[model samples]
Target: MSDTHRWVEIERVEPGVFRARNARGGELHVAGDGGELFTPVELLMVAIAACSAADVDVITSRRAEPEELRARVDAHKVRDETGNSLRDIQVTFTARFAEGEAGDAARAALPRAVQTSHDRSCTVSRTVEAGTPVQVLLA
Candidate 1:
């Protein structure tokens, strides 16, 4: 087997809107207001959100009782001295669960799940931290 970068193609659906298909046959839609291009940072944000949700789902499913699960992840990128790529990134994860006796356990597992996503699973997190550039514009 050879190392090959999996191909995912994106097509411009409309002004500032795009559609993409992943290697795993997943389709995604991306759009923006003001007819501006969707920056890679926005994709990173999407990735973080997706990963956090995936982690929460895994954790919640392992529990004995089926508890409602929800999560939010916020990431901030610090710029380099020369205003080039991102220098540092901080991500915060918040997870909420249905009321139950295992509430504490559920809460405690949130961090672990996030860590797993960041360290082991999330391709978006890994890609962003590895070197993908991110730029934010204020409307």
Candidate 2:
């Protein structure tokens, strides 16, 4: 499917805090260190985790509806002469299914589902892996 045009407006609310508003009227609070909200890096990690979880959840549910699904993403950062950047990212997805053959089927599909999400699905993960380009405009 082709991606739709998406836009978000960001306005500074304070010295280090800003509010981001999407076309849907959703708002997100963003801030730098010492501010009260999620930092930019934290939000990036959250995006990755959420994207992967969504893909895995959908794929697994097709086989067997899961009682619970959780996803965690861990990132390692390094700052050196080369500059600061994330060195590694790891994602862990956990799911619980009903106690029956359905559960067994879900369990059996878990590994493959995760693999497919990481390797094929999950746009955020794929974009990060591809080193997506970013452009900043002054307004």
lDDT per model vs. reference? 0.65, 0.88
TM-score of each: 0.60, 0.89
Q: Single out the weakest 10-residue window by summed lDDT for candidate 1.
A: 64-73
Please, what are the lDDT tens digits per residue for candidate 2 over residues 57-80? Answer: 887888898998999989997899
In candidate 1 the C-alpha lDDT for residue 112 amounts to 76
RMSD for all candidates, in order, please.
6.5, 1.7
Best by lDDT: 2
Instruction: Rate residue 46 of model 2 by lDDT.
Output: 93
